[model samples]
Target chain A: GDTEPHARLPTCYPYGNLNVDELVQRLAQAGLADARVDDSKEGLVITLANDDVVIQINEFATHIISANSSLREKLRDILLECLGSF
Target chain B: LIMKNNSMKILGVNEAWGELGIVSHQLRFTERIEVEHIGPVQALTSSLHTLLSQKLGTTQVQVVSEYQLSVADSVVINIQDDNDDPGKNILLSWTHQDEALGSKLLEIIKANFKK
Candidate 1:
């Protein structure tokens, strides 16, 4: 029998030692809402207009988890742009 | 926290619905670990189940993906195998409050999947 194809997985990019607090502020400035550091201080959790997105960042990389592909891409672009200025 | 050789990524949404309490982690395996008669996700999941069961001394580890698993109802892990490429990474996530359990799970994963 032929095997089924794997589902599309989200991508993770490495960014050395991001200033997550500052990044959250930048995300807010970019009009993203509810952007705050998670209680664990392990990552940032942000809520989109119609979807909930969790962006987890540590010393090595950042992870953006969302079901909406388009929204995730948009958020990724905005995040990279914010990081660019830093 | 992130691992030295393992990069983390997320793929799916929070199935828990409207609950920010649900957290996820993704990690990539450096080399492809295959099992006959199963896909990458299932193969990984099986390996995780075995490892976690042995380590945790229980057989209740839930296989979430080839690279992902859940244990003791506290953490949920997802391994990434994008576009049919053998996954080299994994994601392990949990609620904000379960930091202790999360850390233990991460350690188990790191020990087994060291790059």
Candidate 2:
């Protein structure tokens, strides 16, 4: 009873929906990070540090698509570009 | 950086060790920020600095009020850390006021560093 269980995060988006490969490529293109994309159950986490802003993107597919319509569009656009890159 | 910038919020916390002699300390959020917030956008910084000053017995200063520094929106304050040089700088954008306190880590240092 002494120890608190843990934190429950209700992320609006889930990572599984994103095209993991293209998402990694898009992040690299944006200069947000540098690393090979790895798709796992743990999901992908993006961390941004622009002087003062600290943004983290962790979500499920439906929530990500619903919460940020524009970001969803960006994801689609980036995926299309990745297709052309190959 | 803005010497008059009260766009920061802060509080103080006293840390110490237990039976294991584990010492803890920092004056972050040393003061509660109760000023009616205009919203969680950008004005929170000013309210924080105002509250922090009264509690910590320190003054809030910004670089913009004086010689311009690269960081133009950070609230600067002095704390009693006789253990360290007390010359470290903390830059907060939209983070908690206690952020600056974290800069003065004293768990391990206090053992070796003499105040």
Candidates in order, TM-scores: namely 0.39, 0.21
lDDT at residue B47 of model 2 (Cα atoms): 38
DockQ value of candidate 1: 0.04
Please list the C-alpha lDDT of all candidates, in the order they appear.
Answer: 0.52, 0.29
> What docking grade does candidate 2 earn?
incorrect
Measured against the true chain A, the candidates' chain A TM-scores are: 0.59, 0.32
lDDT per residue (tens digit) for residues A1-86 in model 2: 21222122221111123345565667568664643333345554333233121222233221111112243335434533433211
Encode model 1's per-residue lDDT on A18-79: one tens digit a residue.
Answer: 56667677777767756655544654444443456666665544666654435554665665
Supply candidate 2's per-residue lDDT for B105. 19
